[model samples]
Target chain A: MVAENKGIEPGGGIVLDGISHAYSGRKALDNVSLTVPRGESMALLGPNGAGKSTLLNILCGLIRPDAGRAIVAGVDVSKHSSEARQNIGVVFQDDSLDDRLSAWENLEFHGLVYGMDKPSRARRIDEVLALVELSEWAENPVRTFSGGMKRRLEIARALMHEPRILILDEPTVGLDAQTRAKIWSYLNQQRRERDLSVFVTTHYIEEAESCEAICVIDHGKVQVQGPPADLKARYGTSLIRCLPRSPEVRQKLLEKYPEAQRLSGDRLGIVVRDQAMIDAFLSEFGSSLKEILIDEPSLETVFLAITGREMRERDEVNSKARGKRNKRI
Target chain B: MSKLTILGRGIYAIWLREIMRSFRDRGQLIGGVSRPIIWLLILGIGLNPYFRGEIYGEVRFVIPFTYLQFLFPAVIVLNIMYTSILFAVSMIWDREFGFLREVLVSPLPKWAILFGKILGGSTVATMHGFLVLILARFADVTLGWDQVAWALVLMFLLSFGLTSFGVILAARVRSFEGFGVFSNTIILPLYFLSSSVFPLDPSLTRTQTAATYPEWLAMLVQINPITYAVDALRGALIGFNQFDPWIGPSIIGAGAVLFFFIALVDFKRQ
Candidate 1:
């Protein structure tokens, strides 16, 4: 038992060690180990049914793993979950806000739940609301807030007590691209300003690139973990996108490159093996082609190379499986 | 002391949220206020004549009180039962809407969270019970300050027990859609079976009582814990007793402790 500072309240960032949880007979997490040292950011990248939520639940002290030690904020979670919860703030995958209450009321409730003193509660309420740019709408009920506003308020409420470790489970799932970008900027700013360690689970590959470290999980196992640049350079692929002028031209391109695959919007994509392939294609068909664009190696291409499937294609297949597991946790 | 203060803040926060929600809901408030008015003002007055009328051509009183006075405290109990037992709906709302997870991840213990919710529910129920006392004058029943104070304490205790029982119901019922109908089924049956609307003659011995009324009806009044709760309030406000005085207060006190423990156990498991 590692003693926390001053007394027995849990303190520090996440330290999940060999933590494994199973639902009846199905294993959701299998010998998972990860660490987010104090004041750092780590993104958990996984598709649906990849155990991201299960991992987040364990970190937030919502579920106790069947086998292994989870030391969240220096406290053994299975033994003292309440204490472990002290240093951890969670924005769950689902909308957990009480829409009936005002934005201020929700923040007030959060502060009190975390045992913030009256003055501090008042002070932090204003600070966090401003951080999310929701200060003017504090007294308005959350029911009237748009989805992006609700997401923003949820983030503000989670930061009310200034938790040492912040755990967000798919924090920006269904929002528009602009709102998604805004939320990420707020989170990045929070990380920079506070001594906060963030462990966010997300399937958005482009956004995951912003984290200091990335862990790609699939089938309840860690497929890879490293900085974004390293993972991209090693597993990522550059592709050439070409729109043929006619059926004859498309046939000729496919004949020359047998591996070329049809993409959306009448585009054909060919994985670039080397620089010579691009030179040969451009010289051969640059004038004849309707359009040609070279996509640089990115997290999307890295995900494709590692997982062997586009992230969106796996959505429907695993959703039912994920739903069954979600009910238990 | 520090730990206690922290737990206190957490409890107070949760309790305050429930109270605020109850206040904001116009529909629940209407039900709480109007329920007692209809039962006491109309039902009691309309039935007052027959409570003291001739029985089988023999002039007699059922006990010694008019129907209005006899039904007053039980009406308070009825009001409290409606508010407290249906407090489960609030729990269901929280669960269905995902609001419960916010507090579950906080530093508060499971027991504290449950206690705060039960406390909030009982407070609202007790207020509904208190609303009935304003009609004491209308019912032709006078009360001293002490009686009113004692009645309030008893009402609070009963509400506490019933609110905890509501939590037990909420834990069992998963869907919010069916809980209102399901709780109505439970509340109305329990209210009717508790002898809230009628009095069982206690002057006769148990065997004679069984012969006079249907055996099942007599048995149900005695067996239902709510019967004693109503009887206890009746004793406090109207100086009435249908059974041994000790039985009413004892059952109420015991039920408050027992049901709360059941709720706490269920809450911890969740």
Candidate 2:
């Protein structure tokens, strides 16, 4: 079965079949399975400690999953990491460029490490540097580059080898909105030009909205995986917030709709299913309610609906677990 | 292209980066230049006149050379030891600052990357050792071009072994702050105990050996692998050998292979 899978069609993709990994005694990833087809952009959405890192480590051939297989570009990552790595390029969450070397030198080193010929190394170094609009600073040390420029250089270096799949871990976490958009543009250009399978893992809901598909994971388990529109439609809620003018109206509204939640600021929120529900709500309590606000369904709401936990509340636990797992080989 | 050619390019890429980094590091260059000068020019000259072994107004034993000539080859060894062992800083920098992952994720194997790094370090260390050889005329030690070339080979092998030793140190050390203590404890004791400065020869006259050095000191010197390395350099540069000449090259040759494999084991684990 493993031999049959090697270099199959849709070779520029990733497949994880029941990949489970544990660090010491605690489970970091538990029987997780997902796929990124060729020429597709998929986001692995998770907060810290949601097993995103462990899955990434396995995909990049940094660590082998305790059970199951990780196949990248039709090569089993654990069994044939060198071949898998040849087909995949990675941009880590940490800054990995040599600060002492110039931007051109960094990309050149990358080209050589990937075993490009001298002529191609020179040509691709020019092409990638220009792609990121870093040709002017090509001779400048990376230490002098701004955070965004460094990020751009890293993106350029990752693509210099011209790998079929590009894996980025939280590519644009701290950048400003303009830089974030520019980075996306560079990434999107690669996809359009090379039909690259771009797999990115990020916690940013707005960022994940731009991908073709989204996978939401939490507590080492994937809760939902589908297109953004499908996820938002299936699990995302459209809430109708009603602020009652009088306590009697509030009591009547609460009795009529048991699911009506008393929201702060003296308002009640109801998960209105369809237009009929909104119409029925308006006809019954149009005069009693002082104000009404409609909240549309979005990926944010879908995440909250699926996870049922506040991101901020898990910050401490997640960071501690992330730290402990990072120390493991 | 063949797979071998591709892997060779990857190793060259890694090695080229180290050479470029070393060239740019002015502080390291300064140390490489200043360390040899202080030991050879100042220390050698200051202690030259007082080096003769004399007792009861008669010379007990003669070393057959001036203090400056005797100290010249050892200073070369000292310079090589410093540069080679401190090559760990580059390894530490890569691991600490995330540059290691860039290479780690590449298609090349672990041993290829490590070999490139060790080769780069050994090359720089060999150059640092050569800096002292250029000053040989001032030490009154005349050498033919053949001697210089032979010493380079021995120096490079010693550097290769010590650079691998540095990589071993890098794997065990958690941070750079501890390296200050590591060099003082490890590099210093290894240098002093290798008989680089003090020649503790077992073949010396019994009275000369007994009056000057202790039995324990001679034991430490003989057991030290670096003693053979320094001895090899002394043989190459000044035609001096306190032990069997083959012993020096054998230990150095064995160390180069042994430490490299050991370092490779640690690197693959990472």
Candidate 3:
């Protein structure tokens, strides 16, 4: 047993060790292990039924895993969930705000739940509402707000107590592109401003690229976990595609880039290690092939290169299996 | 902050919210007071003639007032029980709206949540009873200040017990319609069998000398906790009761404790 702090502590992020959980007789999360170090942002990427929610629930102390340790901000969740809840804030995937209450009332109620005094709670509510640009709408009930506004208010409410760790379960899902971008920017700004650790689950691969660390999980297990650049480099740094006009051009392209692998009928795929190689390939083969494309190694490509299947495909198979399991039960 | 302070704040917040919402809801406030007012006026007046001059031979228990005065405390009991049970529906509403998850995830203890809700619901129900107390003059029942104070205490106790029981039921219920069905099926029968609307002693006696009620009905009323509450309220307000003065409060207090523990356990499990 590790010695635990009694009150709110700073910058002690999440740690899950060999956590295994099952629902009924089926495994929901198997040997899931990850760490979000103090004051660093980490994104958890996974498909549906990939145990993203299960892991988040464990971190937030909502559910205890069958077999393993989950320590959030230095408090063991299974042993002292109420104390662990003190150092962490959660924005659930579902709408958890009280629609009947005004924005200020919701914040006030949350503040009171967290045991904040009247003066501090009042001051903090004003500060957070202003931070979310919702100061003007503070008196309006949440049911009257737009989707983006409500999402922002939820974020604001989660930050009311200035939790050291913020765990958001798909915070930007179902939002417009602009709203998603704005939310990401706000999160990034808050992270830098407060030096807060963030453990977020997101389906959007592109947005996840901004995180300090990324863990791509599938089929209830982590496929890869590392800094974005390291994971991308471990697979291939970049991908170069050349579409030849004829078999003769294809042969010429293959001779020029000997490492190229045949891709579908007359196209060839080559993995490049550096930008210099991509520039050279594009410069020399620009006119020879019908089309040539150089693609930077993105988080999406890294996930695909390592998983051997698309994220969506894995979700479809998992859901179908789950449907069968549910039917049997 | 101290642990007690946290629990106190949580209770205060929940109680304030319930009181605020209850006052803001015009329909609920009006309905809570009007239902019993209608019963006290039309039903009490209509039933007065039947029992105006009728008398039963010496018995250990009886309502020593007019039929209208006899029915007044029962009408208040009916309103308190109804409002307390209906307040539990808000729990299902909170669950459906996802607001319960927020409360559950907080650092506050589970007992505090249940305690706060019971206190809130009871406060509102007690306020409703006070509103009905104002109608005592119209029904020709005069009460001294001491009696009014004691009656208020009984009203609070009864509301707390009924609200605790409602919270226990609400913890298991998932939907408003489901709660409505369960409470109606259970609460209405409890009220009818508790001797709230009628005297426990029948007008005519058979072989029995102490009281005139049937053996089975007396057994049920004695077993019903609300019967004690109404009887206590009647004793406090009109100086007449079916049970001893101490029996009503003691049983109701113990029952409130039991209901509160049941609700606490269920909420903690969730």
Candidate 4:
């Protein structure tokens, strides 16, 4: 069976099977299985508490799963964690660079730790610094860099050893639009140039669209997994917004097209099943419609449909629970 | 390179990084050495007359040596304890900042990381100890070759033992505040209770004090590596041999090895 699995992909990638993890009796991951093929960028998309970070930790050999196996670059991460880690590079969500150390020193130290020789370490440090557009800042202390620069340095540090598989956990959580785009461009370019297998987790739906494939996870399980276009094509529909100006008009519109899902206040929403049904209803009450907007279903909607809660709502709820627990203590 | 060689290189790389970090924070490095330097200067000067004053018809001697004689060993041990505790604080900060996870995830063995940290902290401690010694010499403290060798050896062993103890405490602590509490509750008591400052004589009252506590305390002091460390320094610096001629150094060497092993085990479990 192992040989058969290996035959499916001749080169390096990651495979997670039946991975389960828990923290303090609360299940963080429930039988999560994912296969990231060679040379493909897979985006693990989820809201908070969806176990994306936990799964990434398992893939990176930082934590062991209670039940399941992770194979990274043909090495079992759980059984041969050290070897597996050697073949992979991880960029954590939080900044892990030594603030006091200069960028060059940081890269040099990490390269040496990865067992790179002095010459290669120096050469590769230069290469990665250029790759991340941090060549000029390489001699400056990391503490002096901006948030975006620090993030770029972190990526440079991770890539110093030239690992085949790169794992980035929430890589662009707090960055300006331009900086995020810059990082995305660099990552995509690097992937193309090196044929690297990239595994990234993100809360931003826009970021998810760039991945070759995406896995939408909610509450520790995958809600939908496929190529970006396919997932959107399968579940997406033209959104129709009809501002009826009153609850009575909203009720009448809902009654008219009962199949159309009521998104918010009966005015702004999408018809997931059929577009013509919305068209016919709009024709009947076309003049009454204050405004009409149409677009394909977003990952946000997919998350809502799967988890039965909005992303921000869930975060607010979690924060409240955490606050209450903290207060109680 | 072989795996072990790679591991060793990784450990050295981390150790060098730690040393560089310590030096980069000039204020902290300077401040870490300042307290002991002041103690050496002020206390050594103020208490010299008291030690020379006659007591009970016997001329009390402050061991009849330079100020460094009294302060050198104590300062070295104190440097080890202080620097190791500071390293523990950095370890706690690393935990908060998520760097510990990065180190833990690396291919380097856990023991290498722990021992690397201990060695790194010890190196800083040893350097600080030597700096104080150099300063002491400038203050007219004469040192023979034997005394210098004994001080160097004692400095290294004391550093190793105290750093190992610091690692154990760091591995067990969850927060900086918790570490502070541990340092205050444990470090100060250990320093004072031991013979680092005063002599441990077999006088009836002192024996009674040792007896009332857990046997380990007195045994640990008698066998306490620091006791031998202090004794060794005393023998060299003041020409006073307080401990058993041969057994003291052996016990200290043995105990340091034991502490190192315990630290390694604790690190792995963590």
Check candidate 2 and list the clashing pairs. none
What TM-score, over all chains together, does every model reach?
A: 0.88, 0.88, 0.83, 0.85
Q: Please give, for every candidate in the order listed, the TM-score of chain B alone compared with the true chain B.
A: 0.94, 0.95, 0.89, 0.82
Tens-digit lDDT track of model 2 for B60-138: 3357678888889888888888998899999999999999999988989889999999999999999999999999988
Ten consecutive residues with minimal summed lDDT in candidate 1 chain A? A320-329
| lDDT value, residue B69 of candidate 3 | 88
Q: Alpha-carbon error at A285 in model 3, in Å?
A: 22
Residue A209 C-alpha lDDT in model 1: 76
Q: Considering only N, C-alpha and C atoms within 3 Å, which residue pairs clash in candidate 4?
A: B220-B224
Candidate 3 residue lDDT tens string, B100-170: 77887788777787788789999999999888799999778899999999889888988888898888888
Model 4 residue B24 lDDT? 83
Q: Give candidate 2 misplaced runs (Cα > 4 Å).
A: A1-10, A239-295, A310-329, B55-61
lDDT of 3 by residue, A81-128 (tens): 878887788888889997878999999999998899999999999999
Error of 4 at A128 (Å): 0.8
Candidate 4 Cα deviation (angstroms), residue A214 = 1.4
- Count clashing residue pairs in model 4: 1
Model 2: CAPRI class:
medium
- Which residue pairs in candidate 3 collide? none
Task: Compare candidates 3 and 4 on lDDT and give the better one.
Answer: 3
The sequence of per-residue lDDT tens digits that candidate 4 reaches over residues A123-177 is 9988999999899988898889999998998888887788889999989876776
Writing each residue's lDDT as its tens digit, candidate 1 over A190-257 gives: 87788788998876666677888888888888888888999988987887768899999999999999
| Candidates, DockQ | 0.73, 0.74, 0.55, 0.67
